[model samples]
Target: MKVVIVGAGIGGLTLALFLHKAKISCEVFEAAPAIRPLGAGLNLLPHATTAFSELELLDRLLERGVETSEVHFYTHHGQFVDGEPRGRFAGYDVPQISIHRADLHEVLLSAARERLGDEAVRLGRVCRSVEQDPERVRVNFADPSGAALPSEEGSVVIACDGIHSVVRKQFHPDDSAPIDHGTTCFRGVTRWKPFLDGATMAYVGTYDTGKLVVYPIRNSIDAEGKQLINWVIEVKKPNDGVRDWNRQVSIEACIEPFVDWRFEWLDIASMLRATDEVLQYPMVDRNPLPFWTRGRVTLLGDAAHPMLPRGSNGAAQAILDARLLAELLATKEPLIALKEYEATRLPATADIVLTNRNRSPDEILRIVEERTGGQPFEQISDVISRGELDEWQSRYKRVAGFERERLPQ
Candidate 1:
């Protein structure tokens, strides 16, 4: 069966690699005029990294990214809350990778070109909508100038077009707008000296005022003890604006909430001040659909389930979707395979969407913050028990399909 994959983001390109390996006839159509190295930082959990290992990309990924070791939690008062071992330090077979999104995209695109042939990926084709007959599906595309382009037909169309997916809108026309989640954020990468473990991912403060998530994406970017560190600062918003990753904002406007974040371990304010550029986005997610398939078309990744950036599950779940869908389509017919893919991923990711809203792992910090009245605690144990913390973390891991016990070998 001939398949058409839309959106050449992480999910689309990876799906092309998987389908090619399975010997399934498929092609990828991208909306961008060119494949530029775009986006900021990203996290690849063990489940996602496992997929890379299977594709023989583990070594190259390790070279381009920092292998994350643990997650350290703290409060605005600069008080330690708790921590958890991640990747190999946690005894998982694979290591979690913290990387620049552009680096990861380049790796996937390179692999796709090598395996699927350079002509397999067609850029500058913005998909408008999908039309289908009993025998095949046709995807219409428009050029950058708002002019119509020749449509392409295939056995099925899988939309990986991202949060603002036009293809998803064509199907779920009345679905509510993206939920703002009451947070506006700025993510920037700064070249600075390493903090804590150098490979640790740290989250500080609750959403009551501001939340800071920081980690090093590159090990060494300079000669005199410098690392390319990625950081995200989020504050409670009065109302949500347009959520665009490419939009940038001034640090001064966003720095007030974090100026006093001078902990013994690291100076949050100074690190943010050193960033070369800061990309802004509104934290948002859509209500999950009961179904993602209408005949031969379906959704994947941010296009299907745009969860909050609370957990590192976004790209991981997209990889899972692409893997499962390609496997099913390689064996089953188009209609049957698309339904199977939807049934497998829709509810699973839907659970992640809802869980991320209320009970994500980061909620532990909020709990500690609220329980301690946002004050510095003499002992973290005085606020929450180890049992409670473990339960809070493991539940989200399982819901997001990255539970250690259940990971595919």
Candidate 2:
């Protein structure tokens, strides 16, 4: 069967790879004129890592990304809250990777070309609309210049288009607009001297007081050994700010909150100032839909379920969707397989969507911030018991479907 996969982002490329492995014929249509590595750092939790490892892309992922050693939490005053080992260190078969968004995209795209052939992905084709019949579905595309392009027919169509998915809008036009969480973020990558273990992902401060997530995405961008550090400073704001991925932000506008962040291992305030460029994006997501598949057409990745990036499950969930959908289509009838895919994933992802907004790994920091009055704690166990911390972390793991105990033996 010929399947048309929309959007060549992480989700679309992964779906193509999975389908290829299943011996299915498919094509990826990307809106972008060229597929280039873009975006900042994306963390692959152990669950998502397992999916990729099954596809045999783990070594290539590690080669292009940093295998994150631990995730650390800190107070606004720079005191350590908690540090936990990730991936295999946490006893999972796969290791978690903190990779540059573009690097991961390249790895997936390169594999698609080598395994599925160069013609597998067609660029500069913007999907306009889709119409499905009893036997086949027709997808319409337009050129970058807005000229009408010939339509293509397929046995099934999957929309992997991201946040602003046209296919999703076509299906759910009356749906509520993306829910804004009243937060604005300033993100960018800068060439800076490595800090800490260099492989650690750190989250500092509180959202009410401005929080920072920092990690090194690349080892050396220049001859001087300066690492490409990716940092994001999210502030609780009254407005959603903006939506453009390439939107430029002034460093001065968001640096006031980090002025006091002078941690011993790294200078958070200085790193923001040293950034080569800054990109601003609003933290927004939609309520999960009841279903992602309709007839011969379905949704995958961000299009299927857009969640806040708080837990680093944005790309991971998308990859999981692709893997699961590919698995279903491999064995069952196409139409029945799509429904089974939804049955297994829609509710699972819906839990993550609601949970991400309410309780995530970082929620622990929120609790500590509230209980400790946002001050330095002489003893963390007094402010928040280790038992409380463990419970908070465990709850999130179970909800995101990555509890260590749930892994296959």
TM-score of each: 0.98, 0.97
lDDT of each: 0.88, 0.87
For residues 1-409, could you state the per-residue lDDT of candidate 1 as single tens digits?
8889999999998898889878998899998889886678989999999988888888988999999999998888877788888999998999999999999999999999988889999999999999998889999999877799999999899999999999899999998889887777778999999999899999888778588899999887888768889998878774346667788778885788888878889998888898878888658889999779999999999999988887988888899899899899898988999999998899999999999888877788888888888777888888899999888888888888888889976
Tens-digit lDDT track of model 2 for 278-346: 888758889999778889999999999999888888888999899989999989999999999999999
TM-score of 1: 0.98
TM accuracy, model 2: 0.97
